[model samples]
Target: MKVSTRPLWRKATLFKGVVVTLASLAALTVQASPAAADDVYGKPVGGAILVKYNELDRETGPLGCPTSIELDNPDGVGKRQEFAGGTIYWSAASNAHPVWGTIGGKWGALGYEGGKLGYPVDDERTDPDGAGKRQQFQGGTVYWHPTLSNGAHPVWGRIGELWASYGWEGGVFGYPTSDEGWEEPYQSMTQSFSSGGLTLFWSPGKNDETSWCKQECVGYSGAAGTDWFKETRVETYVGTDQVKVRAIPTRNGFNNARTDFHGAWNQVWSMAPYPKGINQVEHRSLYEQFACHAAWAEERLPGDWNTGPTWDLESWLPSIGMEKAIDPVEARKHKCNWT
Candidate 1:
């Protein structure tokens, strides 16, 4: 979309050299917009990656179990690799059943990883989406913790690290974050199951559970059996509600290289550098979707949500009249500043 950040209104004074104050510059540093998602297909903000993907995997019934593939952290700063690998399996059904997989498997560890959000081992039942006080998913069970990491892990991690590491770029080995707060998704597996056996499913949120609707979930071997290499074309939209897909890769570096489609991590990194940049700098998630926040270089353009003096992010909402006073009485009372 045409999201804007506060702009830098620099004026050259004949008597001074770049006479900007630390306070004004500091004001410009504030983030005034909603957080961005790091899906597989989208572009990055000035500082962090904007990861986007169409859909990881669609949920099928328990029989439609998926497998977890291990991922290596490229940053080389995370916890042990054994605990770092991602996994896939059929989550416990909304109902209880005998345990079938190794408890140490990726899903199992997170299932029992006790925390405020950790699923209660005492509960015998689970919902398809892993909601409720004691619901279970393919990876583990769900419990509500104030932090994202407290619930069953779609992949292994403390909630904050998971959200921060995999911003608007490709994850080291997993799916990117989404706009749904802690409700971000990793991937979904589709497979087949029989009544005699139990199936497992995994999702970032209990509200995200879906039935395969008879869609077939196959094993890796089964996926291999299909003509996966065959060319397939599907119609889809790219970019956000404001930016046009055709206008992406803007000639002036404004909305340039913009693609509404899910993007690759490497590509996202190119647009928004890591660390101090959007794709890499780690910050508290702006909103519940928990996407990484932004940190733009001096050379780049900012989004409408920026808190800089030149751009009053609150007043820049596209629907609002452009001339409206940025510091309205309500905004001023709340300490809202353009910078």
Candidate 2:
């Protein structure tokens, strides 16, 4: 759309019954919002500018300075003005609203008006539940949940698409607990939602748009340097108090196999019991090669906390009929949404 370069943008429709509303608003005698300081090539006017200025408390509007003059979109779709703090967007159907801050930043990253989310249908504000912040875009809404380490993060795109399908905040996922984080192993980004009960993971692959898992899953396979890396994470306990002590060897790459424990040079696993129990797990050790042997593994002793080169865990694969290590391993992907 074509946006006017002028400071004042006049629309035939806004001149209609809006005059009565503007006059009534003027009767309030509230302080008109002051014009922005930075992009001040022109002085602020009185008529339509005053109405918009008054709509937002002068000097107190969410958007501070008028970075760009109010103008009609080239497509003649709506009205908009850029500001220091945010932008005030107006549509006859949706009215005028401010899109700013974290939500606005994310909207910009998604391409603003040119992005999938066409326009700001409404302002950036809290949702009905008051759990987190919300902003409406043309295609969809962007939501921000407070982060423990950082202030907050944004969740958008296909993840947002899936979130909408799950019933938004009211869905089983509930409000987001953390912003998105990139999983180097999976070549994906995931965000915690539903108070960590459910996690939404989004992959770059067009087909693997989004997937929800309880705990982070390095996954069963991926190419080297992709999402592949051997790990034995105790994902979750049987319940709340019990440490069921579950351990499973996961395929680190797409070429991972039962016989080949280490696919790429990028592989290792660790176990600690020293000061707590007394054990050590390090590669190039006896245990690292023979871990598959239940008897050999159980009989072995753990070393000091920082000890290394413990036991041999090799050839255990072929002993168990696993000869080729380049074959595909089973894919047993788990879910974070499971009860």
Candidate 3:
């Protein structure tokens, strides 16, 4: 065995050298051959853009085929590539993000990366509320909903902060219907939401304020008294609307009423919905309870009883003595009598 060891060792070294040479040739072939390179729609696409394109399933996915090679962004800080479906933007700070469909269209209208939104920081994703899609950018966020005819809209700045406070798309405001704009008379920034029914306004040195369509008055009742009386009315509508109660009183009878209730109670209270869910039956029942309470209060007030005595509904919450008639949760937990 020892006599043949030299020949065997030389043979093994020669085999290894051949393998290395072949590997080098293979690598060179791959580098030089356009056929072996990464190409989308006959266009060479590489780097981060290519990686993202692949992640999105290449030509088979929503991104379709590449229309342009990877190019430097106008800002010079990032790169972008166009595809049949959308564009992939890459930046050192934001990595790679794909914007497509209505969301992409909106971002483009806002001036692409050069707009106030800057580079997109995340891909378009289903909103947690499950009603729409949303994408985050360096400066703001864009949202899209199928039911909205205006397509996608951007939300940011103070108005964005306010929307976020209420729960974003899922909140009371729902999705934004309009982009932020300036109000010349008030010198404030304003944005519309809830299908243009609600508008949020922000001015210098002032907190955000909102105005929405006045809710339809669903229920009404009145109580009259010779010297003093109060009438309570409940107003609201279905679908993410505010519930308000108005207490109208005769000036001569309710002079002792709370100062807040001048001629009538102008304070407006808002609640998500009755019974803590979106049940129409329960909501209607809740409204009926409010009307019942108004009638009961009107009947209970003391006076000559010519028409009825107007009473402050807020003061009668604890002693209204109608817990059995109304759901304890609705009556006590929500303080439905006042709010």
> Which numbered prediction scores highest in TM-score against the true structure?
3
Model 3 C-alpha RMSD to native:
12.7
- Model 3's TM-score against the true structure: 0.55
Q: How much is the lDDT of residue 281 in candidate 3?
A: 42
Clashes of each: 69, 25, 14
Per-residue lDDT tens digits of candidate 3, residues 1-339? 557546787999999999999999999888886433487669887877777878899899998988988889888899988889888999999999898888888999999999889999988888886769999999999998998525899988766865686678887567888887766743556676762255555544223344221322222222222232333333333333444434444544333333232232222122111112225544443444433334333223453322233222222133333344345455444434443
Error (Å) of candidate 1 at residue 304 is 16
- Misplaced by over 4 Å in model 1 are 1-104, 107-312, 315-321, 324-339
* Candidate 3 off by > 4 Å: 1-37, 206-267, 270-339
Root-mean-square deviation per candidate: 35.2, 17.7, 12.7
- The candidate with the higher TM-score, 1 or 2, is 2
lDDT digits (tens) for residues 1-339 of candidate 1 = 986564444323522444456556766666344453221123222111111111213223221222322223233321111111222212122222222232223234443333222322222343233432233443333333122222323322233232234331123212211111221221432211111121122222223335211222211101111111111111111111111000112222222212221232223223212322222111211110111111110224554322221111111122222122222443343332222
Local error of candidate 1 at residue 129 (angstroms): 7.2
For residues 67-150, write the lDDT of model 2, one tens digit per residue.
677777655877777677777666666666677777787777877676677777766677666657877766776777564213
Alpha-carbon lDDT, every model: 0.23, 0.46, 0.60
Q: Ten consecutive residues with minimal summed lDDT in candidate 2? A: 330-339
Model 2, TM vs. native = 0.39
